[model samples]
Target: MGTKIGVIGGSGVYEIDGLQDAAWVDIDSPFGAPSDQILTGRLGGVEMAFLPRHGRGHVHSPSTVPYRANIDALKRLGVTDVISVSACGSFREEMAPGDFVIVDQFIDRTFAREKSFFGTGLVAHVSVAHPTCPRLSQACLEAARAEGIKVHDGGTYLAMEGPQFSSMAESKLYRDAWGCDVIGMTNMPEAKLAREAELCYASVAMITDYDSWHPDHGAVDISDIIATLTGNADKARALVARLPALLGPERAPCPHGCDRALEHAILTAPEKRDPAMIEKLSAVAGRVLG
Candidate 1:
């Protein structure tokens, strides 16, 4: 197998075509079962792992997806690069429906989730000031462009706690005051957890609606969002199809420092480190300990 690239498909992106030798692999992480059984296969001669964030039938809610379990499963599968494909509402006028954005920054507004792996017996704080791996983001942008999709190079994604769409006031605040490019649910703890797992993370934001900020559009419509999500899902698949080609057959260390995020993050003294915690973290932090 080649370098493992993990792809987490968001709403409406439950399947990826053209993966040869595909087989469903049920992964058990210390956190719990992943959103769904991981699909492992090869694309363009490169090994890839696909996991549907919302489960196969879109059963999980935004707040319910096991973010920690998902990341841990990817890590256990030896995933070096993770690409999160998410449907988002545009916060900017230029980022219209059907457009794609490679999110480079994030403002996490998630309220209910365990966003870290180092706590309790272990104490570690990884810097998330610059979260997304630039190299990976660049590759995703290039892949989208090469696939003939309209792609924005960089943007800040505001991850809100929601199965519900943002209110007009909240949407306007995020757009006008905070200056976010996109808004979505589910990217929070996912992004944070990816860092803790030492995986190079990149998100491809598929614009599905205009939230409630656009005067021309009424309050975010679930029906319209769902319709747009279908189209965006197709685009997401096209973009993913070109990823292996863009990334090439070999793997390179992340130029943006994403792969070594936990280098100095483990603060517990070696003798004081909890054996159980170390055992649990070994799957993700073995290199750091070694």
Candidate 2:
């Protein structure tokens, strides 16, 4: 009934100040287990949910992240807006480590994951023409600025399938050829799935390296990234604290129609639709399918 904010990031966001009545709730998802138990609470006079993208102790790899389950779990818990905070490698010279980028677009090169909720018995297609919610992105940009973090208002994120960092050639191609602002292993299917779930979504990419393209910096090192994450995580927490106040405690139909994504997207006729599949979608597409 009210504006429910879902923050998906690292474990640090759970410690954000001003959260009241925090509790870790395990939710059952039609897709499967989410990355971890969702931490639910109230912040800035609005309901809030924080999910650790990689699960506690950093168990899941990039390709292995349960993107569908994560999105569905948030939707099941009544989260209306989703904000994904990811650690990324910067392509631009000025977007250095510790900086944040409010990502507007994505170039997905990931091939080894289920990128959608509709398939087989339940067929559907949703436009990702503009992958993220612009209104939500603006709020994130303001939040990061208010936290005193260096945040770029717009960026294009290149999503790669990886547990491996990019090679110099691949990195250069993304920066110089494809013109990507940041590169990360996640965010492709995650963003796509959010659109399908009809949730307003935004992304905040935390720059942690120059990738392998910068002549001055060699290949990326996990140790350096780990150190940078310690700082970025703090800024992420500060940014999260600013969200609820800006978004408020009431809901509005997304001006961009993100909430109505399924209005004409589902292809399967009601009579021909699979009862099992439709039942599975009861929560995700109840507004349109039922």
Candidate 3:
């Protein structure tokens, strides 16, 4: 099969433009309904799928996004690469508002959400030591540069569970103590589930504000964030538009083993696994299960 790129849009980004034969596809997944219908079509002669992390009209909150179903839906559609474009607050002065960071590491501090596709019935563990696919991330970096976006090549993202912005103390902890480069709400379980689904994933964090850490910036203001978010969204679209041309309509095995994550991850014996659970995981774990 040829390469099919999936773009998960967040915050101000609701849809992508310039897709040929674009259609909003309702893909069913055992996990649940995805955040919204996925928009699938061709861009630059390469298959592309775009899913709004929050449903259209911004219905779903960051914590409420159906991470499992979103990943499963894309995998079922044969999406080989998943690129997450999300709005974030920068921890570093250099990664200021309107900048884009190609995130390579994550510190998942999120809770109150389903974080895996495997559980008691189907026990499995995938190594996420290096979660984002390097190859895919490099493409994002190049695309952003080509769009004249001030892009940072690598950064550690601190994913917090939130419908609320971070407190001053919390922001300080993540920036000063944790050495995190950016902070965002979505992207934790989403990144984790992508690894489990054996789909290569990359994250592009668009900086909107300095999260209560900068003395001059003070607290995060909704008005300011929304304003920056609007500009960032436009650049994000341009960056995504350039991806298909760089990645081309061809697929290759992930050198970093993102596509083979479940090779030795499943621990349950064939007979020991629950039949119902196995059936539910068919789309996500079909290769290993078969």
Ranking by lDDT: 3, 2, 1
| Clash numbers, per candidate | 0, 0, 0
TM-score result, candidate 2? 0.98
| lDDT computed for candidate 2 | 0.91
Give the residue spans of candidate 2 off by over 4 A: 11-15
Report how far residue 158 has shifted in candidate 3, in Å: 0.6
Instruction: Please give the distance, in angstroms, between residue 270's alpha carbon in candidate 2 and its true position after superposition.
Output: 1.5
lDDT of each: 0.90, 0.91, 0.95
In model 3, the Cα lDDT at residue 223 comes to 99
| Candidate 2 lDDT over residue span 1-290, tens digit each | 69999989842343455679999999999899999999999998999998988888889889999999999999999999999988999999999999999999999999999998888888999999999999999999999988889999899999999989898999999999999999999898999999999999999999988999998988999889889998999899889889998999988899999999999999988888888888888778888987
lDDT head-to-head 1 vs 2, winner: 2
- Candidate with maximal lDDT: 3
Model 3 segments more than 4 A misplaced? none
Tens-place lDDT per residue, model 1, 166-272, is 99999999999998999999889898889988899999999998999999998988889899999899889988988888887788777778888998998888888
TM-score for all models, in order of appearance: 0.98, 0.98, 0.99
RMSD in Å for all candidates: 1.1, 1.1, 0.6
RMSD of 1: 1.1
